[model samples]
Target: MSDTQFLAGPALRRLRRREGLTQAAMAARIGVSPSYLNLIERNQRPLTARLVVSLAEQFDFDPRSLRQDEAVGGVEGLRRRLSDERFADLGIDRDEIAEWLAAAPQAALAFARLYDAAGQGQAATPAAIDPMDLARREIERWRNHFADLDIAAEELAEELRLSNPDITAALTDRLRQKHQISVRILPVDVMPDALRRLDLHARQLQLSEMLDPASRAFNIAVQLALLEQRDAIAGIANGAQFSAGQQGGQGAQRAAWRLFRRHLAGYFAAAVLMPYGRFMRACEATGYDFTILQRRFNVGFEQLAHRLTTLQRVGQRGLPFFMARIDRAGQFSKRYAGASGTLMLETEATCPLWVAHAAFDHAGRICTQVVSLEETPGSPQRWFTIARTVEGSGGNGGGAADAARFVVVLGVEAGQGAALAAARGVDLSASGAVAIGMGCARCPQADCRQRSLPPRGKTLVFDERARGLTPFEFQR
Candidate 1:
């Protein structure tokens, strides 16, 4: 019935402490009981409008300062960060997070800083969150399709007489036969800042000696990928039909080219390391247990997941999955979807309720949820989602906090959800489907209590006479 809220408790307590007044004195000034003031100070009660007006009139405390400081103190950002599944087991609630954010904004922000520092990886920055940010949109655009590249890689492997596990040997032979380039592992110091570099004039490829066996092998495989799929990658890049502002210029063209090249190179590298046939069999046998596959191939979880998304070779297709990777802040650094709809997000996360954040809670554990998103008009996109939180090897002496942490989500569609039942150890779809929208600003669902803001087409009407539970009600 009232627009008044109890958000300013932290600020009020601070003011009382600063003024050296007891709760009784403060309550007398604000025309409230000492017991009620205790609840207000402890955030048990809200800073009422009447109390605020009385404080302004009696104690001369600025009402504007109380509102500004209180609003700024809420831990909405931290809540979003904690939604990462690594911290899922903590069982933190909104109230606790809000108290932390309000009582010590600096400490809360410092933790955020620590999180971002630790989560430094191939993450898309906040600038990429803007809908019209072309370079980022170009990058995300190229992320979806490795289907074409998968075919090309398979063809190249056949041409080079290659097979898996003995990838280094295959790479060496392929290099010599196809490109006449020799592979060498040079000292890390000699390689400068690069892990792998091509000395084309010398007709040689050099890999940094500092890399372990798996990484060293991957370097060669990536070079082979570049050599094998260069033409296809180039075609995809140049053929991408961007709009007038993003495409007509040489700079945008070059950016698009880089995006495709990187995507294809990664795809080809994964293909070479984990050949499609072998990888598919592994997935089928294990029911997509990534842990077993990761060890069998000696590849990272990210690599395993990326390879899975590329399992779209026409006759030999795996699940049509939507893979999204995000950093600690829940910003979508990379996202790829196969066969069906696309998740064109304005932010890395649409709501705190999304399991992308929950991945941080359980840390090393796998978390699954059955969610439905109405991205399309009539057809709702359902995902029996699987997510895992990945942590960087806390090697070196930098301590555990220095290790980068991120989450990877792989979502399989309707019929596909049943296939992962073996790996999940239960019926994933048994949870039924939790209804969701694309985003608060972009989504059309009007009745969602989880919406942080109203949809773009609607406006909040301010009524001086009445207040409802929600901030706004739509007319359209």
Candidate 2:
């Protein structure tokens, strides 16, 4: 279940070489023939769980380390390096690059470096990237749903609690009894990089002193999920591996594991805090009042929004919501859609009219509107969108007010907007849905007043005397 169908031929060969053993010797030790090992080395066969355990027992190798996607970071380096528009028609997607990394990591790293070197100054600036982005995109492609983890988390939520109460205590007790680990809060100066650290040798789990009470509780819940619900996460990940196919490379697999753990943790925490049955009733009764629900669960806006996206448990499902959070610069830091065919653009924002762009001006005020995508005018993808500014903890110097402002936008497709408290008085059937664009490069609107650049596929015409709202006139 732990993505055991990994094409670990490269890994196996590496291990054999590292141990200074020949194919026959290594194969004999692992209870396999040299010819069989040869097939694995060539990536023609997947390493079975039985063989993996045998190797671990014989060589004292950490199975986890062996299974980890080596040069996974290099895959990202390659992605960023190759994403330069210079190689726009490279004929290989990110998944193909991931496959190259898995099949041959050394070559992949070398290729990434070469690609980076070649793209000297091509105007297509590589965006600041999250290491987990590859996995995030892959998960989003699947609509952020992991049936196994969701089912298990829901069951665990019901078994663990009565209502939205005592989450930290419950998780702490679980850790203490199940994993023999005690939770402790430590200063940020002591543990800087991470909010939580597990000291397995000392049987202690450390939470950063910098985190708020709710965050501290969430950290505890996450650790509990990792310790208790590991198998569920692995099962979902294994399933993703086959479904992913080419994307299920070494680096991508590594990222997938992290995303699965993070997602499973979130699901578990949300389930515990907002019990499915109870939360469903509350959501309907309160008309999905976000702030009210946030108070009831003692979770942050981001957490509340994330939990709302996962309310797809068949009979007690809530509105199919799509939520995203971005910095003032319009970089999406977090994103999820409950259903497919999202109206939100995943790429850079070129449209100044999007409510998220306006959210920065009106801090703390929820801005809601029924808007349609500018790319497809009068398209049925019109969504009821609400955006607001959220301030993070300003730990560097000033107070919380000085912290970075992130805009959180939550939207539901046209028909479901009326049930939302934020959507009050919004006409779902209105023809006045404002058109939006993906970005300047992708937008085809010839009449955009604020257009910065012409669409990629169109030829821009320059006129000497005549001036229009757009600087460039396209040739159809």
Candidate closest to the true structure, highest lDDT: 2
lDDT of 1: 0.65
Q: List lDDT for all candidates, in order.
A: 0.65, 0.68
Candidate 1 structure quality by residue, lDDT tens digits, 17-86: 8889999998887778999999887777777777776776776566776644222223444554554434
- Runs in model 1 with CA error above 4 Å? 1-152, 155-164, 169-194, 199-214, 244-248, 344-349, 377-379, 391-403, 421-431, 444-450, 461-476
Scored by TM-score, the top model is 2
Q: How close is candidate 2 to the true structure, as a TM-score?
A: 0.67
Q: List the residue pairs that clash in candidate 2.
A: 374-436
The 10 consecutive residues of candidate 1 with the worst lDDT sum are 120-129
How many collisions per candidate? 21, 1
Q: How do all models score by TM-score?
A: 0.59, 0.67
